[model samples]
Target: MKNKQWMSVLLGLTLGGFNFAAEAQTRPNIIFLMTDDQSIHSMGCYGNGDVQTPNLDRLATDGMIFDRHYATTAICMGSRATVMTGLLEYRSGTNFMHGHMQKSTWQKSYPVLLRQAGYRTAFAGKFGFDIQEVPGTKTLPVPSHDFDVWKGGEGQTSYSTKKNESMKEYADEYPHCTLSYGAFGRDFIKESAQTGQPFCLSISFKAPHLPRNADNRFNKLYKDKIFTKPDNFGRENGLHFAKQSHKTRGYNAFEDRDYDKDYNRVIAQYYRQVYGVDVAVGMIRDALKEAGIDQNTVILYTSDNGYFCGAHGFGLKALPYEEASRVPMIIYDPRHSNSGKGLRSATLTGNVDIAPTLLDLAGCSIPEGLDGRSMLSVYEKPTATIHESLPLINVWGVSASHALTVVTKDHKYINWSYAGENYEVTEELYDLNRDSLELVNMAQHPEAKETLKKMQKLYDGHVAHWGQQAVDYNSYQQFGMLFDRTKTWAEKEPFVVELDRASHQSVK
Candidate 1:
């Protein structure tokens, strides 16, 4: 482990994706594909018995499957910010009701840094958040100018290809936005290949999201098919969860109303949308091969955040639970020696690690003040560990469900500070190794006393770091006081966000 750490640092200083090159390293083309509201359960590689995702499964087989990867901030807007900036949500200062990501932060993002360092960079599909010159100012602009090819849309991009402004060209052919994004990647790869330049392409797919408008081509594909429910599927499994965690749409699955009424049918429709992404994944890989850059191109697939899919009796996401924050992550670097080794890494990783890893593959220096470290070392050796701990945050939505949680490779600790008339300051501890479904809460168990104390110390360290590094503007500075476990509910209640940023909205 010590040797791996030393060598990874050496590679960070010197080599690109190709491992330990004594001379100059060949920079590989990077393609990052991310989906909306995808869970680890959606893929066949993750041991789902019902779903059919051959392309994603093949990518995992061709390279490595990350079993413990997570989105540090488990929401679309917030997680996307963390993925791009290599920073935590508080430091990035980006979310729906949170604030805008500073232009300076966007400048340090992987695409910007890679382009500056002589790599062609392209971005398409849901751009997620707009950039401002500062955190608090209202002057926001789409960062299309930052990338070489910008086919990105703002604000939860439409699933219909014709609806998205930059993607209308493909609507006549693809119709659906999921396949249009794939075509964009194919075109970019073909163009970049002809230029003989290493390129970084990111395609964020708006598939498998809510409101159930999956591609018609894939409609009824999963019809009459009953999906397998996770072990922690019903309300009985969620009784031990904190009461504060169940105040919003996140708890809708337990009510058996609307989308949650028919778990089999609704879950099947979600899988059908994921099936659209699977076909798109196949398209990108086929294009790479046709362009003859397949051997030198690296591909990574993950999600902004995970869907609940009725896990822990929760229908939607944004909770600090396994099915919500623990997303699907796969990295295939064909230029590296470790490629095609059929590896599964249990090392803990997070959304912030994506930028650093991509920059490292491009042979660009990672900027300072980043909370993420490159996961290429873990990619090289499946047993290696890059991140020992990461914070899972949810400061959006109703205040009752907003909480701060910390997770390690083996255990997780969550703190819900919204204590009042109906809720108390709650704590949850789970030995994730033994209870991957989060079916058991060891917070107050007698045998978990020693483990709980160690996790509490880790939790404290995160809170301290949040205090020191959280953005001072846009009400983010208050979460530090709000998340403090030692602070009383009365003392910290005033620190919460003041505005009701769509608290009345049905979905977060």
Candidate 2:
């Protein structure tokens, strides 16, 4: 390298040395890939000694791995909505039972903004939520016409490729949805590269999520493999958890999912399903190289949410615990000097930051009043911080599991306000720095009183924000009082009667 080039590289490595406008004529192509219900523990790059994720590991090596990335909402639909709009769940106003995303919000999403900015955009796999013209009006079809290419499906898209209408063409050759997404990515990359226009391809893979139906091609990969259990992985370790959390189905998932009866078999299959996603990642990376656009293209990879995988005796995501909320995040910008240095950042990031990050990379103006900020600084300098704290919300499923929590780098505070009959209002605190596995609840610890009070203040701020800014529709406004610590259980009782009645019976 020449002296001037070396100096330029050094300057680019500074905290705020972003090259936002150097290439006015050509912006890097962005490929955002997300998986469903994949835990950070499932990846080889995340220090899982038992998994095979060479492609993702290599990507981590070539880029920066964010160790503290969290899904603001640890469920599929809510997390996806947060990622799309750079808003928290109450503001996004879209989830399984809440409702559809408003057309106005969808218009301002990252994809629509990028498309409007004259970039080629494509989408494939499960489009988590649909669009509604207005709050409670008739729903519209998935916004396929907004993108240059559309292979996305609605609802829980099938693992069988042929069953998905848009992906049927690749069914014969790929057969399964995981590999079919890879082929779709390859084709999109090749076709986009030919057009000389910057492209953004977002592929949402349905692997490692439900119905286990992983590709049969890799059946022998982990056959009869006895997986190592996490330290906090059973009913005993979960005894310290709040009584309200125990009332939720997540607490009972250990037995329901047979993790207790068939530990080795269940885990092997879980990792096996993740393995298929790894293979598809390899396929897409190879396509990028073959298309000769790998250098100028940026790749952002993460999961919609992390799975419990028997952690804390829980099964799937939606809890505020680390295992269920913090997912793997990697950003690779080949044009930056920071590429290929095997870097890892512990900066606090959340799902809401994804949109702002992508929009910033495209040199598009970030919308005003976003809950997240651009991570370009964090990307330029790994130690740089983007968020002081982020919320981990769970309003889905049984009312007992519903929580409002806030997490800083070293501490997490969760509040379960569902107190009717047998349940009581509960508060749980964890010292993430000392007990990342959540082996102990520090909420009642005498020495931790000061820290607990501080976290409670932060939690209160989030609850206040929910009251002030949450959308008026979809029953979101009710949560303002329900989650308010100042509000007594008597004040909250009337709002939760129906939910309590329905959930109490459903869980049993």
Candidate 3:
């Protein structure tokens, strides 16, 4: 199987006629640490005074911090798919709630690319996406034989190793899953160092996600703390879709219990889980240092998607709001002496850029047909703009809550489609420069009509460029029960493609 995989990789390289054999030897080791459902507001480095993230703050101090990073799709599976394949969720065909990542797409992912380039690759912690399991269909195991080391679990893995009955060997000294994953990471780092090969380790932690469980050691950290609600915590000034969600989704943080009690308890537990992830980060960093490769290794820390801690009266993610889409990203390269340490870059970047950036840094030939460009230049030129605008999509199956949002540095425009019909749309416009909290929707404002037109044109262009052929929404509707709220995915209409860019000119 390994030989066959290598043959396919060689064939691909030969067909493309690109080689990086010479540059591969000097490439720096890569460590990508990702947390589940962690927002920038939850991190100390990003100026959240309530949460304690000493390790992540130190990581930012050692490297560059990206202030305007976002996820193309603000959901776990879709965002993870984007980071892995460098493609939009619609293009990758992995946008559904439950399905395996197609093998062809998986082959082009960073792990496979780095492994084929003579770098040892390892993946630990939660492998976010799940494989489709039809009775007669063949499927690969959770961490599918692609890496030299694979210590991961499917779906939302347990917080405690004792609950994870299947994998005992990978368990750490403590029963916590974060520590267990960290143990795997440390072992892989040591192995890579002993072998004298450049390594790429991807750690995806399942912390601060749903069912927010924290270790007992951190139970007292925020027990007496009074968590403040977001300024837009209730239905006030929120979009209609968000307000409707609050009415229909009873399990959401806003609807589950008393707002004050639930918010404080959940927020505390969420912070505790984040603290656990921080401890894991410290462990991985110490392992890198102990292996004597800390300086040569590049450490990247980010999240799959941002979670709302009672922002806009929303508890979970999957919205195009800033709290749901904006994530924390840090790139630490110890060898970058040209710039001073601890630089903060406000360039607009997203999860899709991760694949291309890692491949570019490793001197590998990035594949064609990727939606994102390498952000390596942004690190060199902090003032440069990687993207003028970014598209945020939330089309999960046949969901009526689907939205298409176009975001620039200064503004955000959203077009919400009801029942998968493009014609039945509700628009929202926010000048981020003036209303950073998105308290005011300027879509109906007479003075903002021109801005709304420009944003719509941009959204139309993105749809034409990245949209896929019509998919059978009914076929995937069977998996709707796997999602959080049934109402969000109950609408069974097929997606409507936007008008052609050539025919639909911008409204000047």
Candidate 4:
């Protein structure tokens, strides 16, 4: 295990060094592959031991992997909005860009800019913002005219055998192609290549998200891999900062009733689902090569948000911890003449950089009023730091109180505010040099006062820049408007141990 990890580290370093040597001779076709509820810790290239991700790892070998990449807000709509717009979610006026898509004020998304720039823009999988007719949200496809090829959001069940079972009516809202959803995105790539037009394709996978219900072929693929539990699993709540809203209940946090076997079972399946996504990535990448456009394509692989797979004993997302906030960012620029090979960058970056970077790559002028800056220059110089300290912000799913955070190379600090005042103030300071697991929260410790103060000041600056707003996460918490009060998988049905055992034995 140590040897494997060392080898991966060496590969990452080699890739990082290659960043500056590459140059783009041509404007590349861009394929942006984003997954739902994926964690950086689950990929082989990102230091996961159990997950098989040859495709993404190959991309890392061929491009760049960002070590400190993250989502500004760790929720579906907000994160996606940030990635698409290269702006803070608060700035977009759609901080909690979920369910109510039609009513949200984000009618003008970043993809619209790409569309105007003469690129064939396409979107697949999940489009953020809840369209469910509710009190606080407006109904029917909240007016976002972004993307030329908008073909995703098949809901929870599509791509699985049960794709038509659970959310049959819901899936009907979006166009359902007979080709597996991944292929649909690749098909767009093929069409774009044929049309001789530059394309921006967002292939969003609803995998490794929930229920761990991947296609049977993928589900049956890695049934025997052992999943090691995270070191910080099953944490006591009071030691950390007090989380806002009811979302941090027993279900989201680690359950005392769960044993090692149950936890591993959930995680192993999640990794397997990721492997399936990786396979799709490989297929698309291979297609790009076959079409002879490999060298002229820029592929970006990332996720919507980080999910805690038994980390901090949490089953759901919505936390500021590294496990739930830090996501994997892989940028494979085949046209980059300097370091076309894998490059590892430790610079502080976020989804907010995505829009500007994409627009910049296409030679399109970035729109004014964007809080994010293009990192194309930094990509050429791997060690060049663009963001000295990046802001990480998130609001509660149940209420309006919001958390403002800033993460630098050395420390992390977060502040919770409610009702236009400091309702609950807590801070965390970690020396990434020593505590990778984040077991020690040194915010209140007198010995770490200076570091905490620095982080606090940075956090304050971010808060002042972004400002306070009645975001959706808070609205869901305080008003329950965006909150989906449905029973969970465990709540809806008892765990059938017999069925799992039978399947396991049969596979063995």
Candidate 5:
């Protein structure tokens, strides 16, 4: 009887070990693909009749698409920082080109947590954050040691040049920087799969951002395509341009040339660059399948921030407009049985939610004090809502004109503050249900007074919750001068200076 009892115990232990191994094998591998300055309106699946994005369209068809995803800050560095740390710009202190993220904040980043949890991680392409080049400092704040593989760029990498260290290997193999990024991503996936561990690969593409350069092969992709101008293309509402100062307008690419000729050529080139990104997407997908990890991988695609293709007479982002703040978000999780393939979700999501959602999906412990909530519930149920409202910020360095916008499902409220020598502020409201394009501002409309008041309350609640305060131009200018490259090291004695105009260019 004692022998039989011992035999039963050994068999039970064996079964438990087998179950544990199976569970470990089933953990989903994650691949996050991010593009630079890509708007939702520029993609084929998002109703762009002119853009040719077959791979992105296929990814949408195989997964879920979000219609109302927004960036907390409509700029590259701020948005990328939000994605990495799961914290808004105000909380993370990584807003604009002003401050580097704190070391304590980097400890709680998703990649760092995932690496500690035994997942093999790789980061390829642009890690869009501004790091000040101090005279004696040997290192910046970038968390390079958190991943098993790290091939990233400092700022906006060139689209056509091989100057970036990360793209040197693939410079000759691929025609454009976008394709080189994809190739590196493919290699990382194959190498990680060989280790037999669940991997998280992040591919951030530096395409269609600035200089609008594309591979020569794609020059004919949109040659015959003549895009229609946006309804608010030419500043039909005089109040819109009134809010922008001359300096802000110059940074926004608002040329005095005719809209027809400029819009067609620039947008066509942008589309061509996007096409190169699409090709790279196809290559990466093929790599996953070739490595036999396709079924167990969750592929997510989004952009750092949206771009303005001549919307409201502006050609770049850094505005509170929908074209700049809203981005394309898609999640393709093949392991999810109830995902309802090709689902369209209108749940309000933002860049801040990416880190927590990824950590939650990876079965890792999400640290406390994260501003973003897990989006896994919304992915499971398409009708769910994550955030009732999100605050949009565009505090570009120490610039005179900055914007704070509160966006909800059906309305948007913007406050443009010129916090310079002369203080001025402008308010604008839009009822999105009636005016999706935001062509009409109802801030002064008598009938919409109650709606405007409600929006104000919501904005106040967000400001209180996030600890946001009015911009202190004096302090901002004093701190900003420390990192100014043009200034000598000895000039670091605290002094207030104008914002570096060269830093506000559109290339970034």
Candidate 6:
């Protein structure tokens, strides 16, 4: 009887060990999704009230949503570098929005680190850094990227008809699809999940971007809704840096546009592009579930930066305004100890935290080169905030000037340099709580003098850290990118306005 009882106990122990090994073999896969220039307020989850982002909203319902998240920089390359490297734009020195990436400086990006860790990694969609025209470009792969599978780069400004200039050499084996960016993303997710190996896949969406175009289906999604312009629309820039930045972008949200026609179409099209991206997210989530790994994959959805979208009378990105810098950052870790349903955290977060967060979650060593702290501890201890406050800085990308913005929990300060130097000569400051639209400037106000001084110190500290010694806070204004007649648009070749005295002469 004793021998029989011992035999039964040993068999039960053996079965339990087998089950544990199987569970251990199931390492979590990561599906990282990022959109270009999408505003946080544009999504339903973020309370846009109009934009239909059902997929992302669902993800929020299932996982955790981070409010008050920010992008380290408001440009494509800068933002991407921060997220991938877990470093600030200043730390990585890839602050420029579009340019060649120095491989030596940015080799420590998370994807490369994941590759080193034996995770099959793939990256797809708009690779925006190498922005200049290529020479008979057969493919658009960045010369420095270490992504094992790279299928990316929409060649033109328009998202709808982005001509596929070339496929990356590594992506040659995969069947290339030229459908809308959404469809391409959905297909990539479907294929990657079938690999049956633990993998890290990044789906970068390039939509709701300028020359904005959407698939025909989404074009009609919100065609009938009466879209309202931003509440802070047409806010004035009391700061010189902001004013010049506004002038450079031609901040005429409602002026040049024919309200009778273009306004509704633009809004509708923008939402459609957003909806298509949402649909892609849903497809990816569904694919994970269909592959029976939905409960094990860590899904993250966010944007590189926010778009002005008619806010502050501007349409494009690269500004220090909240509308341009605040992006949507959401992380859905299935194995997370935090709330599994509809969890919301207001702890300050940004692209800089992405790499460290993922690395910590993966049980990988966080590299010392990064500037961001892993949120793993934040997730465990919600009481402790990451930073007392964070500073935001925006230098010129194509031009030589500075637009510096400082964001606190309740206040925001901006100093614009039109000459790209001399701060005291020109600047703007606003109390966001009192003036959400920022129509009034409190910089020169006597009562706000102390606040301005403190903000100045913060801005100075960031500038020094970033190696922007040329910024003359006293007189910070200069022409960064000069217009050239050789770069004429095909649509504008017919008209010429030559300056004659104080007037213009029309060239016939």
* lDDT of candidates 1 onward, in order: 0.86, 0.88, 0.74, 0.64, 0.75, 0.62
* Candidates sorted by TM-score, best first: 2, 1, 5, 3, 4, 6
Cα misplacement distance, residue 415 of candidate 6 (Å) = 2.1
- Write candidate 6's Cα lDDT for 1-508 as tens digits: 6996676666548755223223224667787888888887679998888788888898887777877677868877778767887766555544442233345544677888776665667777766554213311232347335776666653323343334443433233322222344454455556656655467787677776765657665555886778876676553432333436645553544356432236667777777877877876776777777767777788888899887776666666777777788888778877777746687777766778888877776667998756687766666655447755565656433233345566765567765533433212246677867775567777889999998888777666655544442221111211111111122233222221111111111111
lDDT digits (tens) for residues 123-223 of candidate 5:
87788764333311333655567788888777676775477775687888885788888888789888877767788899898887877688887877778
Off by over 4 Å in 6: 1-27, 95-99, 131-145, 154-162, 165-196, 235-242, 250-261, 381-383, 397-401, 419-424, 432-440, 468-508
Question: Which regions of candidate 3 are displaced past 4 Å?
Answer: 1-25, 131-138, 165-167, 170-172, 237-252, 257-259, 338-340, 419-424, 468-508
lDDT score, residue 508, model 3? 10
Candidate closest to the true structure, highest TM-score: 2
lDDT per residue as tens, model 2, 296-373: 899999999998888888888888999989998999999999999989998899999999999999989999999988
**Model 3 lowest lDDT segment of ten:** 499-508
Tell me, by lDDT, which candidate is best.
2
Residue 19 lDDT in candidate 6: 31
TM-scores, all models, native as reference:
0.92, 0.93, 0.84, 0.78, 0.85, 0.76
Supply candidate 4's per-residue lDDT for 458: 71
Model 3 lDDT, residue 6, Cα? 81
lDDT of 3 at 171: 52
Model 2 has an lDDT value of: 0.88
* lDDT comparing candidate 5 with the true structure: 0.75
Q: lDDT by residue for model 1 over 361-431, one digit each (tens)?
A: 88788898799999999987889988779999998877877799999999999999888668888999999
Off by over 4 Å in 2: 1-25, 498-508
